[model samples]
Target chain A: MSIKNFILFLFLTAILWVVTIFGQSNNPTLMSQWIFDAYNKKEQTAKKIKGKKVIVVAGSNALFGIDSKILSSYFKLPVVNDGVNAGIYLPLILEISKRIINKGDIVLAPLEPNMYSYNHKVGVQVIDYLFARKPLFFWDLSFKEQFYILWHIEFERIWKGYNYRGGSPLTAGFYGAFNIDQNGDQINTSLKFKNQGMFKDLERHHKNPEHYGAEFSTEALGWDYLEKFVSWCNKRDVKVIFVPATLMKHPSYFNDPIEKEFYDKKIIDEVKKRGWTFIGKPHNYMYDSSFYFNTNFHLTQKGKIMRTRQLIKDLKSSLKK
Target chain B: MLFNTYQFIFIFLIPTVIIYLSIPREFKIKFLILVSTIFYSLWSVEHLLILLSSIIINYFLARKLENSILNQRFLLFAIISLNLLPLIYYKYSLFLTFSESSPILPLAISFFTFQQIAFQFDIYKKKQQVKSFEEYLFFILFFPQLVAGPIVHYKELIPQTKEKNWGEYQKDYFNMGIILFSIGLFKKVVLADNLAPIANYAFANIETISNYDAWLGIFAYTFQIYFDFSGYSDMAIGLALFFGIKLPINFNSPYKARNIIEFWRNWHITLSNFLRDHIYIPLGGNRVTLPKQAINILITMAIGGIWHGSGWTFIIWGILHGLILIISHRFNWFKIPSPIAIFLTFFSVLLLWVIFRADNLSDALSYYTILFNFQAIPINIEFNEILLLSCSIIIFFLPNSLSISQYLKAKPKLHWYHSLFVAILFFIALKTLALAPAQTFVYFNF
Candidate 1:
């Protein structure tokens, strides 16, 4: 091959790549649309709610694990579940939380334990999908940050996105955005039963128990963003409460006192140092493995009720003070 | 720093190549050494320092050995030991102490150490002359083969360095390099990585997996390692070609070998050559009695396995190969029908690879038990079966990168269709690379 032919080959490849990306960005898959719909619904609920309300902010753990309706009924205030995928990373999640929160509102944060140490840049998949729906959010980032995220986006994802032929979000059944209730919680009763695949996943974790649990570190970027979020809430007179995300009670963690104490001390000390109001002991929310739906964090319907009742008790005690 | 990554390809390689092509002939070698230093340092600065120290120490020792007369043998032994010290400390400390605590290994310590040792041995035997310090440094620190190597010889590369005409046949070499590199990248990203999940799933669930999944896992791994290492070798050779230097061919379709002896000759050919010339010949190779030859083969193969890693599994893997070689030497397996002999050889290799890939002996044993259990349970895990079958076909039927390169060289010129095919392959591989995190070459751990 001559140099001219080789350059022509490269030119052809560049054109194909650009075409794939453009096609995929214009045609959003059902999964991406579902994510966008869920976000839009939660944002609208947070905006339209009259006066001070209880804002529940977290990852999918809160979306699937919490019953905001129960919290609203007990506290006699409107509530909105502003939870999304954890792959969006904590910094952006907290930034999104700011739009929902208002002065004199109570902000309930049940962050997943791993969120404490999620210091890496946002993943390519999340950025690609979210940027198509919410270009403003991506444009808001600094040029360097935008480039870092863009550099990681793979051509495979664009090709897959372009090839996706699934129907719209409305037809996605139980796992679709339409399943989300008015209070911003996923309330599909078909997901009440435990998934069998979860057992295999849990078995793998059982073999390597140390892989579970939160990796908390003060030096992490998550901590810096979290501290800033608390300060933002303080200045606005919005109350912030930090609570543990619900988790399956694996014997490896709950049975060993030393392991249990290690995590307990880490969470309590970090929360105290930040001067955020932490309600409920970390162990209080850990339920048996049967309560889990599919992942270690997501809860079944009955499990969600149990977790909510515990949260209600903790909130009742802390709100009185 | 891996070749498959965006940062390495776009940020490092493309820029480095353009700059290298534009530089004057005299400065090209020096420029490469500087860039290669930066490349290694990007992976780790501390490890780069260790590499430099080894190069400086080995270069000086080689020069001394070439000039010295008294205690030449002792000096050679000392030089070899000094070259091996860092490798032993970083790689074998856990095995030696039988303790849990072990230090992180310095990258490429094993490859560079072995290369330097070969240089010293050749110097002592008066088979090699000491070159300029800069040439020696460039030979050692050349980034393409610095980490996982074809275990290059001093003679093969040094003479090429001295012929410094940048313009002659530059376009031809660059074009060939692009083709070889694209093929390598496709094999690694599209084939090897896709097979990894199935193998990993079965190995992670050894006790519970059925006989069907066990066989699938073993086959997946068999082809995975072959494509992974061979693809890496092709990329290394291709990158060297970009600078108008040719590297020794490291793989030549070892899966097609009809016997264990043939397998050794084809697989990891450079390492096999090193063991043959340096270790086997010195230990009274095949000129001795049958029993002594067997012992010599066993010792050489055992050292070969130990060189790969510090595990008992690696030692056992090595010894098993030695036993097979002995059997191949004694019996008339080659007299059997060609198809059956090839099948038998491939089966034996696939079995041994389990021990090589396992975390420990117990896992390997359990995996073997599962493989022969004869249970008919269904495969539960989700994997692309089509991809596995495709990889198998490619391994058995494909002409390999070297053959393809030779075929292209025979042609007067590449047609437009060839360029289009190459472009599509390259684009597909790049897209696949973007789909997941880049997996390191399996040989890099050695």
Candidate 2:
């Protein structure tokens, strides 16, 4: 067969397979089960909380970042710290940052510093936000970048859930509302985790959340590209608050002043400068070791509860003002 | 831009091909050079600088080496050092930074450093010389083997840069690319990626898993590395052919080899050749005494391990392979048939992959403890686990490593039936692209 005919056949076969696969009545692949859980987990956590005030913490592997139930109960506001550790390539933060806005909404974004600078991470999110959120805008990007964005559809699944596990039916990605209890504290460290590299990262966070801190990773003028977002929010009067959530660990002394300056002067200082309510307390290290899920960076039930109560009070006044 | 990514295959590869084929052949080399730099820059803008610097420094020095009045050895060493300096800077700099003492690492340092060192060796020997910058640039930057390589010899590639015959190019070039790309896609997307989770889970938590799981994890990693590296080599060779260049075939069914000697010949063929030619031959190869020969192989392989990564695990892996070679030479152990030797080599190599895949030496030791001390081998594999295992096994055991055109020489009759079968398989591979494209070419890091 001619090369043209060969290519044509392959293209047809691809289209046919995609059609058949998508056409099949399978509820969802093993991956989506996690997303469904994340979305539902956030909704259910919010729905269960008794108050109108809410804190929406969004990111990749929402389970990895913080415990959900403990924060919810303490705040009276539904607490959904559904942040996956997926790099910025995922549009979850960018997308959720736009959609789930409200008058009393408190948005907390805590991620690794390396994540922000990656082309793939930021690109993935930008691409998805461009196409899925607003299609006409995707064209403005260079064709290659837009083209790359088109392929990363799982930003939805990756951003919102524990998609990595592909676990059993009831707990596809939601490992039961971040099981914050005594027994859960004793995690199964027996499984020799390949994530020793990650442990090193946590060690960095543990020693000093300041140096190699995620806050330093954020841009100085992050009300950036938010000029459009800010104006849009102003017209809608969706009182927006940007809270750089504390990971409950105090940064160590080794954390240089350069990094500390970047966080204090750039991230936290900039967020406050933007007039968004900032929540900072219960430094990550002071809490008991068990209050952490994996490392010092994330909060355990005690840390989450303490922070959430402070958030409720902070948001009440911010909203009132 | 990752060789393992679908975005590279579908978005970059396809469009680049369409553009190349549409353009005249005179512009093809330049087009490819442009595409290759673009492909490289996707990793980091910083990485591209290293690539361009390698191209410029070598191109100028190579010409001077060909024409200069200076003693060739000193110039050769200078040029070789110049080539390797960037690699040391990019790849080892971080190591140096963190160790607060070691050297900096160059991006794709292993590839370019070894490549330029080979080029310098060739120049010293007067084996090949290029008069034109364009040919030199193409030799350095040819996309197929650029980032990851089957390490095309300058002699083979520079001549092809001069050829602009569109008719021959149209006939075989793209056919080779499609088959190679599809196979590579299958290796990366379907095979390497699928096995990764099991390999990752097993290797990571080696302490927690039973002895049976440890073995399972090691074997999974072994196959993952093979399919990942060999698969990349295949893609590199296939893509080289598309540009009407034939890079030396890097993998030749290494898993099927009966002994360590044969396995090295089959795995990363060019690197082996480089080590043999430069390191081994210089150190008296097999012409020396048995003990000296053993030292040569051990030293060569250990450095080979260090060449793979800065980590000790890689060095140990190299040392293990070298020791296997020496012992096999000395006692002539595993005096078995070809089939059994092949399996044993594969199994032993698979066992060693535990070290290669582990987070560090301690994890490797813990895994080894479980694997060796286990009471029984487990037969049970969960469905996803089994799927990955079976896929990894199939990727390894499969005989047809070469894409059709590599073996076929002239286009064997492009039968419609074969074409149709190829079509069905290609998109089946395509559908798997979105399943967490974490399938990086294991060799890329090396």
User: Which candidate achieves the best lDDT against the true structure?
Assistant: 1
lDDT of 2 by residue, A181-284 (tens): 22112122222431455456566666654444444444422234344455556665544455444443454422556655544555555556666545442232
Once fitted onto the true fold, the runs of candidate 1 whose alpha carbons sit more than 4 angstroms away are: A17-185, A188-321, B98-100, B164-169, B332-334, B377-382
- Estimate every model's Cα lDDT from 0 to 1: 0.82, 0.61
Residue A190 deviation, candidate 1, in Å? 13
Docking class of 1: acceptable
TM-scores of chain A in all candidate models: 0.81, 0.54
TM-score, cand. 2: 0.64
Error of 2 at A183 (Å): 33
**Top candidate (DockQ):** 1
Cα error of candidate 2 at position B259, Å: 0.5
Q: Give each model's clash number.
A: 0, 36
The TM-scores of all predictions, comma-separated, are 0.74, 0.64
Q: Residue B14 lDDT in model 2?
A: 73
